[model samples]
Target: MSDLDLGVIGNCAVAALVDRDARVVWYCLPRFDGDPVFHALLGAPKDAPDDGVFAIELEDHVHSEQHYIENTAVLVTELHGRQGSLRITDFAPRFVWRDRLFYPQALVRRLTPISGSPRIKIRLRPRFEYGSVAPARTYGSHHIRYVGPQTTMRLTTDATIDFIRDETFFNLSAPLDLFLGPDETLQLGVKETADRLEERTLVYWRTWTHRLATPFEWQDAVIRAAITLKLCTYEPTGAIVAALTTSIPESPGTQRNWDYRFCWLRDAYFVVRALNRLAAVRKMENYFRWLMNIVASLHENDIQPVYGIGLENKLIEREIPDLPGYRGMGPVRVGNQAYEHLQYDNYGNVILGVAQMFLDRRLLSPPNRADFQHLEALGRRALKFYDQPDAGMWEYRTRASVHTTSSLMCWAAADRLARIALHIGETQRASEWRASADRIREVILERSWSKKRQAFVDSFEGEYLDAGVLLMTEVDFIDPRDPRMVSTVKQLEKVLGRGPHMMRYEAADDFGAPGTAFNTCSFWRIDALARMGRVEEAREYFSELLKLRNRLGMMSEDVDTKSGEMWGNYPQTYSLVGIVNCAVRLSRPWEAII
Candidate 1:
């Protein structure tokens, strides 16, 4: 059975998920949205034995352990067998070279002997078109070429070619180097280039890590979460993906699987906000450019919830019929259909993402009048549909209601725009935006509240509770101490809360009732509890949630509270942000130490 314990390595240009046994279970080519050349992560038991894996196995393998190299994205896995122990250092080359950041579409794996003589087997399986087809291969003196339908990758190695081709055991007396990358020949000896790349990559990561302003406590956990979030970013266009690989079901046998490779505007505010807290604004600065480009392409009242990394629209969600999903869950999906859903919260998200540029002087360059003009356009749409019905943040298909969360986001959009306008010294515009926000808030307060239930509900005149309403205080739509908020939190606890874990909502959706707890929502509950002066209780609950993370200190989108198994996509940006936010909020002030 799969434990979902995986280590990720990437150069921001490309990334791979290495399981505990050091197999490259998941890696896309060219870019995060590109096809999967190694699709073992989604392979089913019915598929060919080596249908979708790239692994280096020690003969008679017994056990293994994996961890990142301190603060870097590099992963080191140790495999022990009856014969001896082997160490594999894996990383996608990322570092400063030639006075600029160089992130190549290459994965470098170096294997070394750690003990008595150990024999190993090299298994290379590359699939194409979402694992629906296998690629043909041809070998050379020192490399092998995998010819796929749309791409070709060369595997250059320093190990014996015959052993690799024959899949036979080979004695490990010295280190072996393998580089899987573009079809280009190496200029230097394998060991020399690998050594320089490894050293430079280490320096680059350490330098990057040194700049982070993490909390005094939980520094290691925060650093790992930050690095994982950074890896999910596609550098070319500055779009941060929600997660690396997609289609990992939220729970077993559930159709809740969706691709998260594309950038969601809903994620922009949180992503930038979390990074800004780290005092690392480079990613936010770069992402602002991507957001601006998306803004430029938007017509009046036409903002989307998601877009391609390069701002390419029309991500048609479809199923790959051939390949079975992770752990034999069917309907492997490519692209995302959420693009077509009318997620009105997107308007507010866009404004929030860019509003900071107007106020934060720490950025290298701040937004100008033209940027404000573009933001005003989004604000206009938010004002237009604050009370209108569409898919909520959960992307609920076959459902359309005047979702209070969506409407509250509209209020947030107006509120932030008012602040931005005031900052730019446009008093008239600021007052107008403030009035708009006030109107939306009034409507939300009047209608979203349920007199019968003695709490605010999911929508107008509704009785069912929604976990998303928990964000009202966090987003500043309502005060934490407000009687309605207090009552609502109590109502949410009674209905949606499962011990410390909380479900996004208890209502049945496209799928049946959600069995897995949405991890980020639980964190939101912690935040809510702390803000409500329940610090001791919040701390207790937060500690329990921390234990749910895998051995690698990473989390996915959802978890089965009953079994404590992480499900959904790995290295989830939302879940990682929870760690950073909770740590920052819960950590004692520096003055306490001083």
Candidate 2:
């Protein structure tokens, strides 16, 4: 069974997950959401034989250790054996080539001897159509091409091909470079090419991370989270996926699996916002271009909660029955059905995503009056649905309700629009928006708050508590220290807190109650506690939460709070964003340390 104990390597366009033993377990071809080429993470059960993995097994190996190169996507894994130890270096080549950024759909693995002579066997299996068909392969002296119906990849290696082809153990004496990418022959020596790419990629990542305005504390944690979030971005179209793999069950033995490769409007908003906090402005600008496309594609003012990275609209949901899911949980899914559902909070999220365009003068393109007009149209849509029922931010598939978070976001939409209008000299429009925002706020306070509970409820006049209600303080919908906000934080912590983590909500949904704690919600709780002036307490929980990350400092969507194991999707953008937000919020300024 596959687990979240994986390190991520990518160049923003394509990402692959490698397990602790250095098996390239989950890798999608062509793009982030494409066919799974390295599908060992969801391989067929032991009863049925399948080939969808790339692994290097060292004979007599006893233990292994893995970590990412500091502040970079490059991963290093060490395999210890009785005879010797070997080091495997993995990364996707991404650096400035010519004048354009050259981030190909490729992963390069470099293996070298660390100590004595160790024998190793290489297994390269590339599958297609979600692991239903194994690709036919044709080999050259230096490379092997795995040809599938939809895609083909060539693995160029410096190692002897016979050993790889026959899966025979070979004595390791020197380093070998394996480049798996587009079906093309290598122009340069595979060793030289791999080394150059590694050098340049390392330089590229370190250069990128060097520019970040990180906080004084938790610098390493913040950098790792930022890099993880950056890896989730689909650069060609500026769409940030929620997570890399799909149908990783939120909790063991639960069918709450759903595809998360698409660009969730809400998730992308938080992703860009978090990156922006680190002064990684390019991601937000690239994302703004993507968001503008969605805004332009509006028909009848229809808004979707998610879209494909290339802005493809119809995300028809279905299952890939051929491959078992994470931990043999079946029904591995593709295409999220949320695109067809109305998650009303997206209107607010969309506006919030681009609102920075108007305020930040450093961007290549600043918002003009014309842009304000486009945003005003979006504001109209928000007011129209502020009180209407729809699938809230959680995308609760079974029911639609007037969720409090939806209202808070709609209120945020009006409030931000009012602020933008004032900045752009549209005083009349500003006043109108301010009035609209005030009205929405009044309604939320009246309907969402429960006198008996002394805290806000999930939906209007509802009796249940929800961690999402904590968003009220996040968007400035409510003062952080307001009595109601304080009570809401305390109430949510009492109901949803799971040790150091927090569940998304207390109420059960379509799949029944959530078994694992939502990682993002836990981070939000830290922010809320800090905002309420409980810095020491919040810091304690934050430190404990950070410990939940895997060995490589990577987090998933949810956590098995009972066992302190990670669950749900790996490298979740929402959970990562919480790291940035909380770190930035709680970190003392650099001047203080200085």
Candidate 3:
């Protein structure tokens, strides 16, 4: 496998690539949500003729293998070469102190050559604000300052190294140190030393991972998925972003690119469920608290389907005229404008996540209780728009249709509200919500189902089947054995199922062109199959889907089966959650399928 080709774009939130030699060749400092500090992944360098964008040459041609550390947000990459072997573990630790709360930093890169001497090349080049600004460097004994507007990166090294202004490089034959300081200055002796830093980082990670309540059989996958989900979270706001990077085309250069750095209300239920399963009560509680704050911030008449890191409802979608997209996909976009569109499913997700918390009797923080009340009021307000025509979950481009998925979400919201009210002893209000849920359920069965097709349609009026309907089984909208459920699964297999995997739907009918199959939907199909008592088929498909993960056991948003190349964003949280959920389900007894 000498011809092994391995490259990754942290297009989602954290766009960085670690080579086979265990070097992070490209990385955008600060945060994944921040602009690229390394633009090599998007395009070639122009300003620095001799110095390339960012490159790291390993000490030896080591055989490298990589994977995320189980149940924590750390990445471990091991390299074994003719000379010797070494392991490099990388992670951006969660901020613990209030003073360091907003610090967007990553640490802990230990390079210990086990046996033979190996030479390593070190290079540091940072392009600030998505390559829009290049900072001036000032070299010091232990650090180099790259200063830009409102952003400064102090690169510190432990060993005496040559400062390369334009393509300056050096060979390391002994132990060395490298530190990345973001928006902060470094005082060689004042700043934490390499040995102390490594010890603290390891302890931080070990302490956090020790908190997890491991489940039977599938602990490794669950822990990794949970950690990935946590890494995607914006700690300050308690908002979990959909993904880290954006504009990684579903196809090589197609226009299907989108930014996924912002939090989506639709992901609320899934995130809470995943965290709750792992016994991370604090994480789940923080999410609800955040949602409450968002709800309170909304006006009686203003409700957005998504929100920014600060819970701001406004997000203007626009293309960057300068920066070329990942792999040359044009029109790189920032800030999603889908907030204005009506995605009715969000109401359901919010209610479900909050209700889960309520069920646990987790008292809302005193300051956030008012926000929960506001959320309840907003639920009432959403009822007015529930029956209105708007964009569906897929965020389709055409005119609004009564999306089956949206209607299902409406049912979920009402059902959750009814349960919450009942749990809190609000008998009268609970009855009203229950009645509303029943009506929505009736409409879904009556209008969304196609008798001729014997399956649920994507919309109340359309004839197409949607993969999202798979969630019906997940939310208890219908029993897995229900005739309607079986029929919908079969219909989805016919229209959306591609071999062992499932597509979001017929691409030609919805997006006007065919594209890579969505990886998460395929896992959902596996979950649905397992729920329907097709254990043998589910296990077979599950095994096959697991094979699709990249060499590092990481998955992107989509996959091109023919060439077997991952498409869309790398390290997709949704895809990882799907893996965790399915793995846990498959590991359980038949009676415990739920």
Which structure among the candidates has the greatest lDDT? 2
Which regions of candidate 2 are displaced past 4 Å?
45-50
Model 3 worst lDDT run, 10 consecutive residues: 1-10
In candidate 1, what are the lDDT values of residues 1-594, reduced to their tens digit? 455799989988899998999999989988998888888788733566476778999998999988889999889999999999999999998887778889989999999999988899998888888776777889899999998888999999999888887888889999999999998999988888899999999999999999999888788889999999899998888999999978899999987788999999987678888988898888888898999999888876488899999898999988887668888786788999889999888888888776778888888877799989888888898989988889899998898999998898888999999999999899999999999999999999999999888788888777788988988987888889899999988988888888999999867888889989999999999999999988988888889998998988899999998889899988789999999898898988878888
Off by over 4 Å in 3: 1-19, 23-30, 45-54, 59-63, 67-72, 78-87, 95-108, 163-169, 183-192, 362-372, 507-511, 589-594
lDDT of 2 by residue, 1-594 (tens): 678889999999899999999999999989999998888887663434557788999999999999989989999999999988999999998899899999999999999999999899999978888877778889899999999998989999989998898999999999998999998877899999998999999999999999999999999999999999999999898889999989988888798788889899889888888998999999888998888888877856578899999899999999887887777887788998899998888889999988888889889866678777877888899999999999898889889999999988999999999999898888999999999999999999999999988899999999899999877777878788999989888888788887778888878899888889999889888988888899998999999998988888889898888788888888899998998999999998998878
Q: What local distance difference test score does each model get?
A: 0.88, 0.89, 0.67
lDDT-based ranking, best first?
A: 2, 1, 3
Task: Check candidate 1 and list the clashing pairs.
Answer: none
For model 3, residues 435-504, the per-residue Cα lDDT tens digits are 9888888888888889887898888867877899899998889999899899899989987888877788
